[model samples]
Target: MRKIIFICMVAATLFACKSASSTASTSTEATTLSTKLDRPTQVAIKGNWVLTNVTYPGSDYIKVNSFDLADSKCFIGSSWNFISNNNKGTMTLNSASCTAFTSPIVWSINNQGLFVLKIVNPGTKSKNVKEGYLLKVAGLTDTSFQLIDNINVGGQVKDVTYQFQRAN
Candidate 1:
């Protein structure tokens, strides 16, 4: 009886140690995963990219002239221009010029490779005027990166992919 009890105790102790070791390892893995996701991978997305697909309400696929990202400024032709200088974000729509639409856009990246842009007006304190998402393509290149925006309209989200090539 004493020997049986001793064996049982030893087995219980072994199980407890194993459980503790596994819990510690799992905690370490969780920390590592969070750190990896938080760190943004800097990709050079500066260049001229043709808008192969742009989906708006009541519009299927609209062809945009060209989009440019320079000095933290995202310019869509001469009509729409967004400047993110010094982390100060501002967007302007040149309806009279060429790029016309909106301004004061806020940009952020989520873990799921989704680039989000929230457009807000300057004077009006209203909700987000326009919101969009861009999905990252698999093969990331030095000059060009492919992106798809599907959930723009209510219809089926089509893969409007664009390959942005570096200009300067």
Candidate 2:
């Protein structure tokens, strides 16, 4: 009876230690594993890119304030730098006809293939910013990709596609 009790206690201790070790590693590694964006996807997307165009249904009539930064048309020809290694980058408005500015952004591709982005206002940390935008990634390729944002147009949801090209 004594030997059985001792064995049971040792087994329990072993499980407890194993659970603790696993929990420690998971907490630290969770961020990377949180998304299903594989290494290849990350590699393909990490680089300098340009916003070639922003188009949507009825775009010829309605206007959109993209990211609350500027008119959707103004985002065309913008310079964007995406560094997937650190999930951070910058977007610069280069359109001469619109407000010229640049902003820091933190981003990630979530498991659902949503491009989750938080535009960090001037001097704030990404975590403190409670608002973000989610865009579906489509037609990703070595030379190009598209971010499709669902928007409300005339009380109905419509797709707004932002096309990107790999910068030279």
Candidate 3:
């Protein structure tokens, strides 16, 4: 009778442990799925986007420019398209002052969530620019996107933020 009682208790404890382990596994799976759904970066950033605004924030003051305004007319029709496939993209500018009318770009997002854009060998009319530029993604949505960068301006570190909107 004593042996039977001990066996029963041992079996009950094993069953309870198995039940708890199953619940934990299910909880972990759900959390992983939620994270994946919340961050749909590849899909969200794929589209034609036009620069809507640019801002420079300094220690003392902030300067903001709306691309639609007269002073920024040069960038009024400047746009970028992250193509359907994952690898390449394009930038087009309508301003006469721009050296290149259109440019081919190669782009990728790093694990750190920075957007890296590299202009391919530019055409003869284009000014040679450093191939790679990294922009920190501030926010991204179906219609709106924002990138932020910190750069040294006149020996002071300033933040430059760019806001973009879906062109279509």
Give lDDT: candidate 2, residue 39: 54
Pairwise TM-score winner, candidates 2 and 3: 2
C-alpha local distance difference test of each model: 0.37, 0.78, 0.57
TM, every model: 0.40, 0.77, 0.58
Candidate 2 lDDT over residue span 50-132, tens digit each: 99999998888898888777899999999998889888999999999998989898777765576767788987986676566
Ranked candidates (TM-score, high to low): 2, 3, 1
Q: How high a TM-score does candidate 2 get?
A: 0.77
User: By TM-score, is 1 or 2 better?
Assistant: 2
Q: Candidate 1: misplaced stretches above 4 Å?
A: 1-39, 46-99, 124-134, 151-155
- Please give the lDDT score at residue 163 for candidate 2: 98
Model number with the top TM-score: 2
lDDT by residue for model 1 over 20-52, one digit each (tens)? 211101101211111111123223332233332
Per-residue error for 90 in candidate 3, Å, reads 0.6
**Which is better, 1 or 2, measured by lDDT?**
2
Tens digits of per-residue lDDT for model 3 on 1-168? 999999999998988552321110110121111111113575678888997766675523643332212233345457889864544778776666644356777665554576655566656321243335556687788898887656555677666667889988
